[model samples]
Target chain A: MSSTPSLWRRPFLPARILRWPSGKATPASAVYEHPLIVRYCHWLNTIALFILAGSGLQIFMAFPSFGPKIPQHDLLHVPPKLALGGWLGGALQWHITFAWIYIATGLIYVIYQFASGNYRQFLFTSSDIKGVWPMARFYFFRGEKPPAAESYNALQKLAYTFVVLLGILSVWTGLVLYKPVQFSGLAWLLGGFHLARVWHFAVLWLFVLFVIGHLIMVILHGWNNFVSMITGWKRNPDYLP
Target chain B: MVEPTNNEKLAHHLARRDLLRLSPLLLAGALFIPSVRSKFITGGLGVGDWLSEAIFRRNHLAPTFSTSELTPFDQFPLNTYDVNDPDVDFDDWALTVSGDVARPGKYSLAQIKALPLQRQNTKHICVEGWDVVGRFGGARVSDFLNLVGANTSAKFLYVECADDYYESLDMPSALQPQSLLCYEMYDQPLTREHGAPLRFSLPTKLGYKSAKYLTTLRVTDVIPQKGYWEDQGYSQDGGI
Candidate 1:
């Protein structure tokens, strides 16, 4: 654990990804792609999600109706029914309002992702689908890294792709459940109302898992990766043969 | 005899060695992913909406108005409504209660408000992130339920609006102590732009369940009572 890098693809699948730069004239390291626009949107997305999550929990606390358990009780040992008092209703409205913002930023991020043509790097390739073992053993057993590649590594690509698609699913489902009348078309497009909410909630846990893992990678990689996300400039590390 | 100047290489070699040494721990970690998640690893600077949002349910059974600090509220009546054609006046609005009840009729705003009233200040919470401590004055849904009369066979109350807006709750949820057929908000009658004339609120539910611009109540007994979300993927109960 101490010696190995913090984040590894683990080579879960059998396929191998394209290796690092083959015979490159320049350095054989990853170039930072997080530009200013992306950095700003990323930060905004983070803020929006945090507010949405906390407030969302409060909204749930307002109404302790379904499921065998409530997140509040599990986390705080304080039952929503008992802890929320009567104002839970108002708290729910506020949560809903911010939820809109969180959702809107998410929208902008998706549009930018597609429009920027950066999505190509995130998509899977035949090599990534198959060359994972070499990559994994290389990463784990100190074998060789694949040839220098483009944009995202297979692992990062897979994670990013899945998250973006999941974001769409969650939002679509959420809207249908949110305003069945005003967005009746969306509701029908999804299915009905209740079902949409179910899909939205289920996918929520996926992002939570993503968030947890994303944090681990940042800590392991150190400030270089994180600081660059904010300042949008990373002094490339010195490379040697 | 010289050590590698490249820390990453040394680190890599050391990591492989460590992994070989800590095979058992790695195996365990792989088996129970949650253990690692519980270790409190997080990314990003300590800032913004995403963090708060992480804790919230993705889709809210709540309304999404006033999303940003830059937002300005166009407040009117508590139960305000946006008229369908802009040709209608809100004061002439009425509430109609039907389905499995002794009485099924549209009671004008005055008639409904005159029946009974209660006023209390409470917080309005949204799933996004915000709260407002405002006073609500309105008739208890239970009182109105009693007026039309409750049937043992009926297990839910469906609130319908003029613009096809609709929401429903289990009889128990609808008749809960805080449930109301609200007419006044903050201190004034519901403005047309607000959900005027009257709106419905089940305090325990999210804002969406509040069903502004309420015009009718339909009582019925059914399983999987369909609402906007029920058709999507949200659970029908929507408690949490």
Candidate 2:
């Protein structure tokens, strides 16, 4: 079932996802991560992103100064560069290699979700959206947390939304670093080879931000959330928070 | 009794409301939460292959090399600059075998290659997190063991490279079908940069243990004589 490349051309998804329209309530269990294939993409993205974070950090440490190098390294005491290029004994290679596979896997994933109905019900919602203001009020203001998100919390919705949109950016920028000459247009769009690197370095930081916050949310919520994904078990109550 | 009944109803309503609010939170957790993002986070993969190595047997499988991310010109560490370098000789290179064998002596590259050639397509695992699907063609070390009638006493197979780097596989892992004394890649002799003369290719183990630049082999019952990574934090069984 996995081998055919043509399946990607016309991804198959259940009709239930297609039938639903946005804003109308779809039970979280009914549409949120129902298919095992979509769930697999979630797991793969989560894992691969963090792996990139760690290994990318190891590589980006090769140049620590963030944001344009306007003022020279002559004045400030800066962190020394770390290169997995050869230093971590090929960690960089593994990062890029898995990234290619990760990209392919995500392509399969998004294609499936887009073909199905959940993309509108779960992912594309902008009701409260995960804005910094809502996030702050949810945490500090003891607010109701934006009427309880459908498939994802507002914060999650925004984070994933941005990530989904930037999917091409991440892979392209990474490629510019991996093989600058091969994908010259990407490098050029990223503002030359050196500028592409600057963005690459910056994205690594963004990933770190997402991860630390992602973890805190997980811990605060507890194992009920964890068990659902691993076991594919969801309890049905009359209402969703 | 009426007052008490009224209080109980109020409490029940609150509890029911909480349950209503509790479920989506539960579902979200499953969709978003993951405990460990990476198994190779700390220092790459430490020998997880030991399990597969013990359970499965194949002396012919070989992982392809096109998958190996090209090492840049600046980063490629080529040990042998010229054939004439005094450190080694292609003609005189010998793979010596000792311990747990009826005949323990060095065999020249020609003699080793002269053994039966075996080939198979197997997965090459990288600790960094990618797998290479390729083919390796060479003679099975098991075939070599059978030829010389290796004594049953030898429980470990120690393969050492000319570079001081060393790795070992348990007798069971060593005897796997994908395990072979590989001499050819992509229909050409394995290059020196890729452990050319004759290297043992076990598709199941992570790339690190598949030592390149082969120089010697020893079959022993001892356990400490394992690959360098095993001596460090890496797990002893380097199976995929």
- State each candidate's chain A TM-score: 0.67, 0.68
The most accurate candidate by DockQ is 1
Instruction: Report the Cα lDDT for residue B147, model 1.
Output: 76
**Number of residue pairs clashing in candidate 1, backbone atoms closer than 3 angstroms, sequence gap of 3 or more or interchain:** 99
**In model 2, which regions exceed 4 Å deviation?**
A1-52, A59-241, B1-87, B90-93, B119-136, B151-154, B189-196, B228-236
Residue lDDT tens for model 2, A86-138: 33334553365457546876798778767754465345455554355776688
Scored by lDDT, model 1 comes in at: 0.55
TM-score of each: 0.43, 0.43
Put down candidate 1 lDDT per residue, A43-77, tens digits, no spaces. 65665565455544554453333322212222223
Q: lDDT, candidate 1, residue A79?
A: 45
Assess candidate 1 and give its TM-score to the true structure: 0.43
Q: Indicate the fraction of true inter-chain contacts that candidate 2 also forms.
A: 0.00
Evaluated on CA atoms against the true complex, candidate 1 attains a DockQ of 0.03
